[model samples]
Target: MPPKAEYIELKKSIDTLIEEVATVKEQQKTIMALVEQLDQTQADNLEKDKKIAILENRVADLEQYTRINDVIITGLSIKPRSYARAVTPENGGEPAELDVTSTERQVAAFMQSKDIQLDCNNIEACLPLPKRGTNGKPSVVLRFVNRKHKIALLKQGRKLKGTNVYMNDHLTKRNADIARKARELRREKKIQQAWTANCKVFIKLNGTPENTKVLVIRNIEELNEYDV
Candidate 1:
């Protein structure tokens, strides 16, 4: 070939190579932009997950706070038939319905027997829970005008341990389940002592120097934290 023809062919090849480099650079820029967008989306999702966790914790705290003023008395013997007959007329007439008054009087008498020194006026409400099966005595739920009186009653309840009386905080169903599990753990020798107070389940491990561990259980998912 002639020299002029060779020079023209080389110049055309150089132009094509430059265009290819520019295209590659544009593709690189697009890929980088997509990667940056993905990073931002992941960060936003992480922050949202954190906020959701915080909100869930706050809701649990609020639920527990509502039950702080309530207390439960178990092992209180209640013979529905006897009590029903006691308030009835001797003429074999219709049995008088047992109202909250009768239940309150019974609770007051129990407290007196325990020497708890609680005023009847301080009791805001009293009701008996449904009898469980045949052997379980119906528990009594007591609401006080103030939490202080409830605390006092609970403190004095220690004296009735040897007897058939037991007292505990009135926890919600979720906390109650946790408390039951905690006791089961203790029975299995996994923990030294497990109890509920202020609607929280506490576990004390044997040979541990620290105090009891507070379990913050929300659902079955959270139980994994306690190795449950």
Candidate 2:
């Protein structure tokens, strides 16, 4: 081969290699840009999720506050008022609405019969809850003017145990589900004891001290963490 021809061919090969390197660099830059964009989107999504979780917690807290000083009386039989015949909200509140005076009078009367005194005036609001009752009755939820009134009534609530009247803390929907699951776990012998107070569910493992650390369960997933 001639020296000039060989030199020209070598130079052409070097130029082709440099062009290929430049193309690879461009592709690399494009890929890096895409990766950066994806990273930014993920960070924004995480921030949004964090904010949503915070708002949800705040909502849950507010719901908890509403039921903190309330009690659910499951078997207190409250008759449908005369409005049951025919009544509208415009004319008057429905039969199912909160008849504060009627509820207070009936509750006070019932308590009087039980020999357990509950001042009707201490009741802030009383209405049937949106839950079905045992034996085709209605479950009533009552709120007290003071937390002390609620606490005192709960202490005396035990006297009405066999009277088919049951009273307990009014729990929010989420806490009620958690409490129900916790009770089921206790019944299955998965835990020593489970009870709800102030809409909070607590469980105790076998051989744990009654006064020791009572495990608070927030969700059903937390139940799996228990060794029991």
lDDT of each: 0.77, 0.81
TM-score of model 1 relative to the true fold?
0.65
lDDT of 1 at 122: 88
Off by over 4 Å in 1: 1-31, 75-101, 113-116, 129-137, 162-165, 208-228
Per residue, candidate 1 scores C-alpha lDDT tens digits across 14-123 of 99999999999999999999999999999999999999988986887688787788888898865443334344566477666555447778878877887777787888
Which pairs clash in model 2? none
lDDT of 1 at 140: 87
Any idea what lDDT model 1 has? 0.77
Model 2 per-residue lDDT tens digits across residues 126-182: 887554544465678889988888888888987897898988889888888888888
Error of 2 at 35 (Å): 2.3
